[model samples]
Target chain A: MKNIYVAFCCEYKKVSHSKMLWITIVLFTFIPMMMGLMIYVVRHPEISAKMGLIAAKASLFGNADWPAFFGILHQSVATIGLIGYGFVAAWIFGREHSERTMKDLIALPISRSYIVTAKFLVAIVWCLFLSVILIAVGLMMGKWVGISGWSHEVFVHGMTKYFVTSFMTLLLITPVAFFAGYGRGIIVPIGFVIITLILSQFIAIAGFGAFFPWAIPGLNTVPEGTEGMQLFPISYVILVLTCLAGYLGTLAWWRFADHHS
Target chain B: MEEIITTEKLSKQYKDVLAVSDLSLHVRKGEIYGFLGLNGAGKTTTIRMLLGMINATSGSAHINGMKVHAGNTNLWKDIGYLVEVPYAYSELTVRENLEIVRRLRFLDDKHVVDAIIDRLNLTQYAHRKAKNLSLGNAQRLGLAKAMIHNPQILILDEPSNGLDPAGIYEIRELLTSLSKDQGVTVFISSHILGEVSRFATRIGIIHEGKLIKEINSEHLEQLCKKRLRVKTKNNILAREVLLQNNLICEEIHDNMFELESESAIANPDEIATLLVNKGVPPTMLNVVEEDLESYFLRTIGIKGGAK
Candidate 1:
């Protein structure tokens, strides 16, 4: 327990001192702000004449109300959150190899598993912080746009769904963390995330998102009564199992693999 | 003396390439063991296995009688190491990097960081980010990280690399002091036998993934060959006279006769007398000992930098 804490402190220092943290914050902030801009354009069609392509893009949202805005935010969190959160995990685990600093960590008095756990903890906090930013900024944007249909029940339900979607997306990052270590850098893991993202979209379209771990998070964004969109109980089991495999894989790689790098 | 570090039949095979082959050696407490090898000669691989960063395919390594493995984190408490090129978090400052190492090493006192920085002559660069540091200073920071906790054993691979002449001398003196005063056992690896011969108590030469030779520094001189080189005014007549007298002589360069015979080397004055009698007086008669570099190359079967 003490070893994990010490390792966590060291990992936190690295994250706090890095530019990647601020970069992710700005990116998460920008994503929701852009979503808000689209809502604003839809709210006032007069601005559509001046906004050109952005106005045309906002037309896809149909109605500029709280439910519609919350729906879009949930979907955005599922997709954008996966990429963003995966990037965070990739950087956290891969930076050691890209910077040739893994050797220092592997042979320390502290177990490598502790260091790996600390990294995951930091990555989790960082990704959750980004999720919070997305929701907060999105809420502020909705208030600024003055979209109608605001209610206490809607806010609570929207927040619960949004956070649940975000939580599911967060669980998927364990595989990204594993790839980062196995690949020994950020590029391979980022590539893996991209491939999974593309596959999730296709697999969900094919009605198999319930079985695919990467597709499960995005499918959670769909409304409950939608035809063919409802998830099975086993979907949760598969997702949890995938998360465990990734977590165990990462720990085992760090503990057993020959780290020539 | 207690053998604090030991490897028995240790070997590593990488998909058909044998990196370290059945190597066995031991380092007694407080002795500086210099590991000498050419490039791709498995010095770093051995160090990695010893540090538990990598596993041996067929054998084992032990530190203070404890087996080395990734799960054996307790074994690292008394061991400090720097492998190949030392790399740190480029964005962190020197002080910050050392502080991270201190925390990871479980040292509560923050003063150890400053003390190691001062000891390594890195006080001026403490606040400087590692990315901005020159190669020499970066190497210093790596050494600082290894020594901050002041472990009982230091396994360093080419610790003196990227340092200026004075910096090299300073590190040499510092390492010598550490071993002498603190009883810190050092296992350092380098390709430069000349430099390692200066302070290493014992030297091990590894070539083609095998330990070919291990000798004490005191016995290294005796192993080096000696020859009497005589430069005479009339080399042609001198060579003939030495040959006629049953002393094998070869004209090495610029009319200088090199006599490798024990009789000639043991009694240079007798050769001088014989040369004087033959009226081909010697100008320069000096006994030349082979340098460490040449001896190392010869031992590796690569004389004069060629295989």
Candidate 2:
């Protein structure tokens, strides 16, 4: 237990000191800021018309109210959060291989399993921090834009849904970690993320979003009364099972596989 | 003396290549065991298997009488190893890299990091990021990481690589002191026979994934062949005179005779007198011993760098 704690602290320090962490923070902040800009343009159509193509595109978010603005934040977390969290996972797990530092960790007094687990913990914490910061920035930008129809009930509901969607997206990062280990670098895992994102969109469009683990998170962003967005309990089960498999597979690969790198 | 490192029939077969084949050896406490092999001769493979970085296809390795397995983290507590080229977190400073290693190794004393830095002469580069360090300093950081916890057994692969002559000498002195004063058992692998022969108490030469020769450093001198080389104005006459005098001699090169006879090498003065009397006065006559490089290549069944 103590060794795992030490490994966790070391892993945290590694991630915290990396420039990638700051890059992710900057990237996540931009997504919400872009949503806020769109909300602002929708609130004033006369100005949007006088502006160029970007203003015309921003008017697509109809009726720039508090609910519509929250919808933007929710959907962004479901989709953008998926890619962002996947990037974090890939960087955390794959940097050791890419940098050829994996050998330094293998022949240590601490078990490889502990090191792997600590990495996952750090990734989780990093992704969660990004999620929280994105939401906070999104809320502040919404207020700055003066979106109407704000209420205590609506705020609680929007925040609850946003947290759940982010949680679901974060759960999918384990498979990304596994790919990072299997590929022995960030390229393959990041490729896996892109493929999964593309496939999720196609599968969700085919009316089988709940069946695919990657599509389920996006489906959760659909409004309560939306048609064809209903998810079965088995969808949640599959996501949980996928997460478990990835978690265990990564640990086994670290502990049992021949670490030639 | 207690045996600190022992491998029995250790073998590793990778796809179509036999990296290490049925190798067995023992390293005793306070002994500097130099493992010598040419490039692609399974030196790195053996070190990796010993460190449990790779699973052996057959056989096992034991460190401090404990079997080495993937999950046997306890065995690593007493063993400090550097396999092949050492790489660290390039973005982290030299001190930060050592701190990470210190935590992973479970060292309680925080000051050990500073001590190791001072010992390795890395105090100047303590705050310098590893990526900015020169090759020699990077090599020093690797050695500091391995020696931070101060384990009883040290298994290093090419530890002196990428160091200047002065740095190599300093490392050699450090390793010698560790083994002598602290009783640390060292198993170092290198392709440089002269460097290893200078300090290793026992030397093992590996060829084609097999242990070809094992010699004590004390006996290495006697094993290397010595001969008398003679150059004369009339090489043909000199050869003839030596043959007539019952001395075995061969014309190695133009006007030069190589005499491997024990008597010829021991008493070159006698041959010179005989040559002068025969009117083939020796211009040059000297006894030379075969260098370690040639002896290594010869033992591995390669004739002077050619198969």
lDDT of each: 0.93, 0.91
- Give candidate 1's TM-score: 0.96
Best by DockQ: 1
Clashing pairs in 1: none
Error of 2 at B305 (Å): 2.6
Candidate 1, residue A253: how far the Cα is off, in Å: 0.5
lDDT of 1 by residue, B1-307 (tens): 9999999999999999999999999999999999999999999999999998888999999998999999988998888898988999998999999999999999999999999999999999999999999999999999999899989999999998999999999999999999999999999999999999999999999999999999999999999999999998888889999999898887786767798999889999999999999998899999999999989998999966789
Task: Tell me what TM-score chain B of candidate 1 gets against the true chain B.
Answer: 0.95
**Model 1 ranges off by over 4 Å:** B230-241, B249-257, B272-284
List the TM values for chain B, per candidate. 0.95, 0.97
Q: Residue by residue across A1-261, what tens digits does model 1's lDDT show?
A: 999999999999999999999999999999889889898898888998789988899999878899888999999999999899999999999999999999999888898989999999998899899999999999999999898999999999999999999999999889999999899999999999999999999999998989999899888889887777779999999999998999999999999988877
Checking candidate 2 for backbone clashes, the offending pairs are none
